[model samples]
Target: MCVKCDNCGAEIGLDGVCKFCGTVLPPREPVAPPPVAPGWGTPPPRPVFSIPQPRVPVQQPVQAASPKSRWVAILLWLLLGYLGAHQFYAGKVGMGILYLFTFGLCGIGWVIDGVSLFAGSFRDRYGLPIRV
Candidate 1:
């Protein structure tokens, strides 16, 4: 009977080696697949309704106003507004430096800041209003 090498598709010799590709061939036999359980082929049915999860209430943190006084900020602005002393007092170091270099945007920003301060609309670096 003729036996062929599975790897190289060449005729296998009596020593079970493929003469063309030098591959050893195993004895030819019919291979059967493993038997499956009767009900394992199909998946289990899913539930029609899903359970509702409880909602959690999240609370936000509250920030208190700055302890710095508005009157002191106003005073600093009046005295050295061009130098951004009020900005520094209000914990706005970046704006203070900008104001110092640009002379409070050539005094225009100084006037606007003074208006906002007197009108009770000015805020500190922490975004809290500086009132009273």
Candidate 2:
């Protein structure tokens, strides 16, 4: 009789070790008897009925924005974003100046802007998407 691997359950030889699952059978345990009440035969297997269906197609926006790469923005942010260097690079001179004076809106504005920019919700001063 063939036996399944004790770990991965792949079919293995009746004796020795299993190469497919790489499990060494230390020792076999004593087989237990079934708990049926003597007269009943084994119950029928459960039925599988549902047919597989195709997955739904994902929808994407048709129009795309042309702006600078997300890395440049993130780089400027890392280097001088607190002083609005990233905003200046993105052509938002006013906000850049404001950020320079206000310390990136006292850190609150940049935190929100960082999340929005990374999440694809942020746009440039010219209303172009930041290609994240």
Candidate 3:
């Protein structure tokens, strides 16, 4: 025997099911949709956004002054610069030898060394500035 499906209205065989629609012999109760909350028709509010700010760099602490004296180096450069006395005092042996041989690069290097010594930019063997 054959019967019609209650859900799809298709014909079924003796197994009590619809062949075309796959519906059972007896139809189940219809399911109702969930109830909507109040004001569900309105869309949600948009999210707020803000731009970031640039940050300032922090200042570093000052280093300790060198133990070598600037006045002593200046005096050596003034008196015996052609002989590289100031370079020897600053512990720059190679420059001292060069100055000793070349007469301070024909006196030009001697003048520049004196300028650097007075400007507080001359360094020692350890690379520390002889600013003191």
Candidate 4:
């Protein structure tokens, strides 16, 4: 026997509703996974990541000092003469800057400056010999 929907008068099936009746259906249950065998016990290994760093040379801070005495200038010449430390020490700023740029005129001017400082003939920026 065919059952009829009361609202639409259409033929219904075992689901108790006809196609044109717009009845709501029940929700389905979630599916379960199949059982695993006895011995699958090892954990997954972790991935290793290596990060690269940029290469840069280390630098040292410069300590600049300008001394007033010829003795100090001579000492600086003996120690850091090629770098124009003596000219800076003697208060010859322009010569010091030139010496700094030219590496004491490729060490020849450094030798002459050292000798002049020792001989008491090296003059300051004011044309005055550095005081002992």
The most accurate candidate by lDDT is: 1
Question: Of models 1 and 2, which has the larger lDDT?
Answer: 1
Candidate 2 versus the native: TM-score? 0.51
The lowest-lDDT stretch of 10 consecutive residues in candidate 1 is 25-34
Q: Model 4: how far is 95 from its true place, Å?
A: 1.1
Q: Encode model 4's per-residue lDDT on 85-117: one tens digit a residue.
A: 888776777888888899999999999988888
Of 2 and 3, the candidate ahead on lDDT is 3
Per-model C-alpha RMSD: 9.0, 19.1, 10.2, 15.0
Q: What is the lDDT of residue 21 in candidate 3?
A: 81
* Cα lDDT computed for each candidate against the true fold: 0.91, 0.82, 0.85, 0.77
User: Model 3 over residues 68-101: C-alpha lDDT tens digits?
Assistant: 8999989999999999998999899999999999
Q: What TM-scores do the predictions have?
A: 0.52, 0.51, 0.56, 0.47
Whole-model lDDT, candidate 2?
0.82
In the range 1-132, model 2's lDDT, one tens digit per residue, is 677887888877766578787787877787898678865987767998998899999899776774577888888887888899888888899999999999999998778778877787667888888885
For model 1, residues 1-132, the per-residue Cα lDDT tens digits are 678878878898989899999998767677797877878776768879989989988889865667889999999999999999999999999999999999998999999999999998888999998888
Count residue pairs with overlapping backbones in model 1: 0
Quote the lDDT for 109 in model 4.
Answer: 99
- State how far residue 112 of model 4 sits from its true place (Å): 0.6
